[model samples]
Target: MEPNPDREPGIPTDLLGVARIAGQSLRHIVGAVTKGAVHTATDLVDDIRSGEPISQIFDERVDLFRRAALSALGLTSTETGVPVETKVDAEDLKAMGDAMITEGWDSAQQPRELHPSFVPILHDLTPDEARILRFLAVAGPQPAIDIRTKAPFGIGSQRLADGINMIAAMAGCALPDRDHHYLGNLSRLGLVRFSTEPVADFRRYAFLEAQPPAQAAYRSVKMRAISSYRSIYLTVFGKQFCDACFVLGDYTGGGWAGDDRGDIYLGKGPRLP
Candidate 1:
């Protein structure tokens, strides 16, 4: 799959998950090949020597290698996007053999990149889940209605609630039953917090401690309060979202006033008592 350039830098963590699946498949294929050749090894050798079953050997070996390769790559039986046909031609096999003779396969080495091709931060979350997180991170604490309004896809309140439930399920957390339950779960996870009062008829929520700090004091504070939270946020929004929200206030217009090009002042300058 092609990588999403819009995603944050760094390889996705989901790719590793796929690689692990692939590795397991490869091991199974190797076992199958060994088992298939065990009883007929002598007969196959005789046939090969006599040049009688040359095509049979080629076909069988090619099929075995192809299956093994597909399994190793974690490819499904049916191709979804990319063409996954097996390159089992004799010429290709001979070329691979020749390369192996010169370069040698590193048996000890394992695939390091298992991350998904999409945004690393969102490897675990679906599109809806990620959108929910992003919305929550930006809009602060909010009721389901308000949250839905701010979501990128304009998801309805019910759909947003469903996505939130899905996210909780994916994180191995409890599913929330009501609005308060959702807020409670998110608060417990430290991903969001509620305001003392509601906003615009909706409860306000904020993304608290979205990113762990680098310093010891910050780390200690976060560990005490935010450790239970999943690192999945790091993969979806990346560092920029947290940095802009916490430090720069860029997402909320940095408190700038559109009318006067200054901070929006709420207090009266001089009140006559």
Candidate 2:
């Protein structure tokens, strides 16, 4: 993790009770990386012959483990190791743990398919942003206009802070106060993409017809037509994230995974038909 600007070197002021917790919190992280692989038997025998304490070796590896965990969690760290004053928030730690379980281990203590790529995806997202991804995982691609129109939370009034808080109260999870901003964040993550016209690249995905009443309301407020309607679709990276990190139940068969989008970058999208 990056050094906390407010804390002194070697200080233990993080939300997870300081550096000691790294031993426990990062065990799975190390295990996933090593995947129970071991060095040659001759090398192990040589180490024993040299009288190097295996326990000491493990302790040294634990430091490496901690640094790896922090990196996977998208926290900044030096090539050598975690900074002495690095700090991580509780929410970020929780998200990291969730990612570890989803990508590393399963309930039966069996090794599941590991997706190291998903770690950064989970680490970089806020809880609200992650919730939006999970929603899209099952909900599939939705029209930007419908998100602001027909859905219950889509109503313009719900964009207010208080309205968003109220929705959170019932749903038990916070949502973005402004839908456009939320979608923008997702776009920044390269998980979701948007288009104003029915582009051929995403033509197979659903299109949203702007409601006349909603268009009228936007006109009354002098909202630009271009901003008033859009088609939102998940990129290939987004679908892979949802598959690795979420449960999609029976929804499959080119629904979320339409076609190869290659590697999506910030502000860049696939060519349209």
Candidate 3:
């Protein structure tokens, strides 16, 4: 089955609460890819037939394809008024199609909305960065120092119980270095920030703070002064980005604390036990 050009994918309201691009724009991308690669184009069309929402198939990276299509349409960026040069190669087209499939693009609905400030960031984000954003969106506004805990155990042991450490380990980067690298990139992109003030709602995160083992661990150690720590949080832009893009709903119970490492970590969900 093919996607109906007249309808938009049915995205969850909570997920759609953030901004998104118009369904027309996505259709334009699909049309453009169809002009080139039939296989890649069919990947998106197949999802549309399966009744998947376009939101599932797109991320911030969609901005790139949108810009390219706009350029083809002879549209210019409102900010610069310069014609966007959308010269895509075969590789890029394939990648865009793959991203749509990966994002679960469905053809159940035809949407016509477009986010006003949907500009691609300076650099492409890594899976590690996406992981960090998802974590912050769930169990963030945490101390930077707590993430610095380098508890060494066997490779299979629980190496990353702390949220910050989990992000670092997943990215294959280490502390301070991870902060300076991935975190730094996220900061520049306005997706994340390092600050002393708590951005996450205290009431929303009370359960995590109230966990018995976590409290016992804090009680067992003489932690540094609160003033000495900085917390990492998703900025408003980051939150919107996550909503419009990544499949954050797949995250369960802040599953980042699980014993799984590498690729299996995010799949394990939050470690409530």
lDDT of 1 by residue, 98-188 (tens): 5333322434222233322223333334433433444445443332211121333433312111112122332233332333454443344
TM-score of decoy 2? 0.40
Off by over 4 Å in 3: 1-119, 146-166, 170-177, 198-227, 253-273
Provide the overall lDDT of each model, using Cα atoms, as 2-decimal numbers: 0.33, 0.46, 0.47
Best by TM-score: 2
* Error of model 2, residue 60, in angstroms: 6.9
**Ranking according to lDDT, highest score first:** 3, 2, 1
What C-alpha lDDT does candidate 1 achieve relative to the native structure?
0.33
Question: Which ranges of candidate 1 are over 4 A from the true structure?
Answer: 1-62, 70-124, 133-273
Model 1 residue-pair collision total: 19
- Quality of model 3 by C-alpha lDDT: 0.47
Q: Estimated TM-score per prediction?
A: 0.22, 0.40, 0.35
Model 1 TM-score? 0.22
**lDDT, candidate 2, 31-117, per-residue tens:** 322212212222333453588754444433433443444444444444443443346566656655665555444354333454444
